[model samples]
Target: MHTNLSSLNAAIAGKTEAEALAVLADLFPGEVVFSTSLGYEDQVITDLIYLNNINVKVFTLDTGRLFNETYLTLQKTNNRYDTKIQVYYPQTAAVEQLVSEKGPLSFYDSLENRKECCFIRKVEPLNRALKGAKIWVTGIRAEQSGNRQDMPQLEWDEAHQLFKFHPILHWSFDKVKEYVKVNNVPYNPLHDRGFVSIGCGPCTRAIREGEDFRAGRWWWEDESKKECGLHAK
Candidate 1:
């Protein structure tokens, strides 16, 4: 229940983004981890980690249904950074059971089905990746969505039993793109095509102008708040 982030915030105050991450890396040693989705924001974080040689573990969850552009981005990121980002996959048995029982496209059937697929493909794999990690780094920017607008730069993740540090939480989306461009970081090309939040190919689409950022994801559902359980509170 200890959630005071002031001390941690002050620790990184006046430091550069990579420097702040380096501070956390030093503070937690091998317990610091960052999860990337190969998006613009995450690409920027990956640049900072690899470009700066920060001592934090970087990994991604392969949901077995991601866009080809996503995998291409991962490859380009690895080549650009000269480091291989660790990948975690859903347990084989669980994926087999789900696919054999409900078929591959069952997530479109109902919210429950979608959530089940998300849990099996993303949430569970993420849980396994974050096991024993002390600090969970993320590329969460406040401007991305209304729900994330009030997120603190650093906070305790009760569910993960660790601290979640959003190094660029207050950064604007434009700033994120600028960072990626300036650093020459490799990113998913789908972002240029209007895919704001890239996930599984079948569940995601490119959003048009004036649409909400979350609209492109799970467009069929009537629910305004569409999530795949990765950031569920």
Candidate 2:
């Protein structure tokens, strides 16, 4: 880990998103890029990047199984921001190989199968999208999952060979919603319908009140194995 995590903590201790973004811009210069899923927090970060005219590249993983609402949100964000949000897709051969060997819903069979699906649909494409990028920005928040609690705002990603940055690491869900509403940023409509942590269409569902933010994702699996391979540090 090559980041000055302590300095990042101090700089963002009481600062606003705008302040944090400004510092990030100064620190990363031309190497910053924001990866979005178009969720509420991602939308907030997208809005911040747009509003400030940050020169960061914006991209998304268009897993073939994404919800219709997610695609709609992507369209809306492009129209509203007038910026091209690059979409990355998995290699055709890789996807075809997986589907050919094990049917489309193989992820429901076992943990190994699920990880295989994630690797083909998300992780591989994400790795390609981040090629040559120095700073990988995300909307990850600590409260989203138990495993995410110890994440820092800035850290070294040995897997990606770059610095991973979580701009909203300490933000609460309420704070994220407030920022979205206040800024009128475009977001996934599924969020309004109860999908807290939206992912692939077949793997995600709506969560009830008081459930964990990520309860909607991979609800069929054990809580410890809920994550897709994209965000692994």
Candidate 3:
């Protein structure tokens, strides 16, 4: 069913995010999957999928270092939708080896060490979760980061050999917040505390006034680009 990217893009062209999501669900049925982080942006996408009654399977990666508030939001979202968003975890053996060799807080030491830890914890689990998925849904927005500003709403993910759809790629942060509030969607309260991008607890912090959107995550690394391997090309 996924033999042509042009057809898929045309099918979703000019449609609203929810409408496009429904189109993908109809096109691929069980092959469409969504990854959620329970943040404001993701919570809005969650509402869109659940309310629209889309048949997309939604899941999240647990890096074993996420904030407690994020866990609470996950539970609230599950209860609200009566749908069990799947949970994927890092492999135990790999985690043990990495921790034993580099210690638990090795991600703070250097950019290489951080990316290695991210690969073992977040990226590896994501790969497993998306094993047979044909389309991967996300909450990525252009205004969130500089690199994402030019991204299209729907595009092919060459690395994973699947379609990556950011339903709200062009939506503003205020729009996301408004949708979450209007729909009564469950979201991580950390966003209210200036923590724009929530990931691992120790690796994240609240940003200050006039700071960049991703300023909170990995603030220590000045020379390296501030990103985990999750969304890297």
Task: List TM-score per model, in order.
Answer: 0.95, 0.91, 0.97
The 10-residue segment of model 2 with minimum total lDDT is 1-10
**Candidate closer to the true structure by lDDT (higher is better), 1 or 2:** 1
Top-lDDT structure, candidate number? 3
Could you give candidate 3's per-residue lDDT for residues 1-233 as a string of tens digits? Answer: 54577888889888999999999999998999999988888899999999989999999999999999999999999999998999999999999999999899999888899999989999999999999999999999999877777898888888999989999999998998888888788889998899998999998999999988888888998824777777863
In the order shown, the candidates' Cα RMSDs to the true structure are 2.0, 2.3, 1.2
Give the distance in Å from residue 86's predicted Cα in candidate 2 to where it truly belongs.
Answer: 0.6
Per-model tally of clashing residue pairs: 0, 0, 0
Model 1, range 156-189, lDDT digits (tens) per residue?
8888889898899888889988988887778899
lDDT of 3: 0.90
lDDT of 2 by residue, 1-233 (tens): 22566765576566676676776667667767888999998999999889888778899998899999999999999999998899999899989999999999999999999999999889988988888787888999998878788887878788888878788889999999998998788889898899988889999999998888778888888888777878773
Q: How many backbone clashes does candidate 3 have?
A: 0
- What is each predicted model's overall lDDT from 0 to 1? 0.89, 0.86, 0.90
Superposed model 1: Cα runs more than 4 Å off: 1-4
Regions of candidate 2 where Cα sits further than 4 Å from its true position:
1-15
**Which of 1 and 2 is ahead in TM-score?**
1
Find the 10 residues in a row with the least total lDDT in model 1: 1-10
